[model samples]
Target: MSLFNGTIQALEHSLGYSSAKNRAISSNLANLDTPNYKAKDVTFKNYLAHEFSRPIQAKTTNSRHIGFQGDTQPAGYKTIINQASSYQHNGNNVDVDKEMADLAENQIYYQALVDRISGKFGSLQTALKGGR
Candidate 1:
């Protein structure tokens, strides 16, 4: 189980990040017409860097050695609720073009991550079935 712990953790992190990002984007879209609404974004890279900076414990051959415990939710993935420059007369700062582009890109990345995780599981399944 320790052998695949890193991969599993990475997949989980990716899924969580994507889900949070999607939620933030959806919220922004919903508030598009709200006065003085600013779009929020998830800081995924910062989270990854922070997580990577932490020292990881390696499993030992000793019977008493405990396995490494990864973070359930890493820090630095904070939502930035910065105010956007208002261009419209209604004081709304939502940029439809940028939002749409971001949404599409995020969706594509999420799908790719899902596919990769699925492939990993498929490989595990194949190995478990004696490589049939």
Candidate 2:
């Protein structure tokens, strides 16, 4: 009877990742003119893979095992440093075009995830109301 099922959890995680990516892109854009400011990025592929691969196990020694912990949601996004391809005259490494593109893409992804979560909740609501 968990309101946040696996799909919901995954979508939430993706939303978090998108949020982090958006923040990173914003930071990079903000420091585009700052001297010696290297662009940073958040890696989500590895985290998504790890989340998918990890099994949700309950702490139990007998038949009366507790599933509360196992029912908890997965971890959120993580930020990491990104190596810049080139450095500018002022020692800044942020590429404006790249950062803009990343921001746009991340925004799209975030919106899609939000839509999916909304749809899921809508369906749950419909089910609860007996399809009324």
Candidate 3:
């Protein structure tokens, strides 16, 4: 038996993705004035796909029961350079407004994940404490 289940692993993967996205957004803001610096973004398609691909474990008493089908492959993030028109004449595509919005969204996502992990650990702690 594993100490941690797939859910914990999935949450860790999501946290990593969020951290990467935050870094990408911070880089874009840092290069807001750099000529020809295209703004980069971490795509969510692969992350969502990975999350949905995890198999749901179920118990069955019959041998003919249909089992859940899913991919066990690990999650990954894709960083893409934005091809949008430059907001300035310096050929830089970093939009402060968009980047700020994205940053706020990512921060919220990160905090939510943290809260989820904390809750999981809290449950475990409670169990270990004999429900006191």
Q: Write the per-residue lDDT of candidate 2 for residues 54-95, one digit (tens) a residue.
A: 777544657776554434345555777665555688878888
| Clash count for each candidate, listed in order shown | 0, 1, 0
Residue-level error in angstroms, candidate 3, position 54: 5.5
Candidate 1 residues 28-94, lDDT tens each?
8899898877778888778778778777867678889887665455664678876747856777777
For residue 40, what is the lDDT in candidate 3?
A: 95
Worst 10 residues of 1 by lDDT: 68-77
Top candidate on lDDT is 3
Clashes of 1: 0
* Candidate 3 lDDT over residue span 33-114, tens digit each: 9999999999879868776767776656688998766546675888999787788899998999999999999999999999
Model 1 residue 102 CA deviation (Å) reads 0.5
Q: Model 1 segments beyond 4 Å from truth?
A: 1-3, 52-73
Q: Pull out the clashing pairs in model 1.
A: none
For model 2, the superposed segments whose C-alpha errors exceed 4 Å read 55-76, 83-85
Candidate 3 shows a clash count of: 0
lDDT of all predictions, in order shown? 0.81, 0.76, 0.87
The global Cα lDDT (0 to 1) of model 1 is 0.81
